[model samples]
Target: VGHTIESTVLALESIAATDNIAKNLGIEAGETIYYVKRIRYIDGKILCLEESYYRQSIVPYLNREIVEQSIFEYLETALQLNIGFSDMYMHVGKLSAESARHLGLTEGDPGLTIETVFHLTNGRPFDYSVITYHYEHSQFVVQANGLYL
Candidate 1:
């Protein structure tokens, strides 16, 4: 028996504004934005929750299928956007009522929180995301090789 990671877009919408979304995306107040939320699963078991913010100015076209499938792939292949780098921050946080319900976990459950800001090759920030993963379903591994000269 074996399992594989699966993902599905739970919600995709174009909203005028949201709580702290503009702050995270570094856009002006009231600017148009797209909020994409999805859940990860492994063999029908909940793994983690990921929410991403995309600015309309950066990605002019937004659609459900683009998000439902793979935003990164669409950005690179379809949009031809160059991915420069990403800055990430990780910590522990409690899941909100809504998020916990979606993940089928107890409300206020502790989980690992990862925030990332992706920059384009042109040096402009394009996306900001926050991902939460429970301890039971997640692990962090770092591989190293070679020594300093």
Candidate 2:
């Protein structure tokens, strides 16, 4: 699908990390982290809402300008960070009131949620994200190739 995609920054700030987020990133509680929230659009239609937290010590230069583009690209190219891997969990659940409002849906509407933790080449967790896709606009396609015995 060759369609245009856009990201609008809803929020970008540096804040103290919670215990859960700190644990996920292997950092101490109350450590500084960069929080980013964005609403995604595909062909000018709302598509998803994504929120992310990045370890400030690892990504010190994170800013709204950088996030409006691609953080992964910035990390890999500008910062010369080697992205290792990510652990992802996906599920279908009812949207919270805040998430629903952002997506123009009613509270408790069904939506797809994907949570991910991104790691660096040395296996240090760098970023964690939760993305909620609009139920009506969500489509996922995965392809695998391997040698058969």
Candidate 3:
């Protein structure tokens, strides 16, 4: 599980870096800059979330639009690893509270338990489902269901 989580993080970082470089080369909106804040692993899977930010002082020479898009494409492809939104949201929520107060979420926030499953189509929000899992004397313990919040 640790390896899986690390792989996901590295993949995301690589995509973001690639986009940044492409932007410097005038590629366009193929990539967007994001700061990874958290990663969580459970039941042989990993989840992560990142926040996007802009740096005006460090402008790239490439086409920002193309570079941003390219980055998005890269992430979307990597997500094919079968990662889920529930894990991402929970981990990110915790991370935001711990390391990104600017994100406006706090630890033990009830909202984290709600909205367990999220669906995406073409990188857009589609719908969501609730799920729960528990690991007893095992390596994972996660449990939730629809609309707890």
Candidate 2 residue lDDT tens string, 50-126: 99999988898888788887789999999899999899899898999999999999999999999999999899999
Evaluate candidate 1 by giving its C-alpha RMSD to the native, one decimal: 3.6
Off by over 4 Å in 2: 143-149
lDDT of 2 at 135: 91
Model 3 lDDT-worst window of ten = 129-138
Query: Is candidate 1 or 2 superior in lDDT?
Result: 2
Cα error, residue 45 of model 1, in Å, equals 3.0
- Scored by TM-score, the top model is 2
- Encode model 1's per-residue lDDT on 27-92: one tens digit a residue: 876888888889978777787888888888888886887876668889999889998988889988
- Cα lDDT listed for each candidate: 0.82, 0.91, 0.31
| lDDT score of residue 89 within candidate 2 | 90
Q: What lDDT, from 0 to 1, does candidate 3 have?
A: 0.31
TM-score of each: 0.82, 0.90, 0.19
Tens digit per residue, CA lDDT, model 3, 39-68:
333334432222232221222222333233
lDDT of 3 at 44: 44
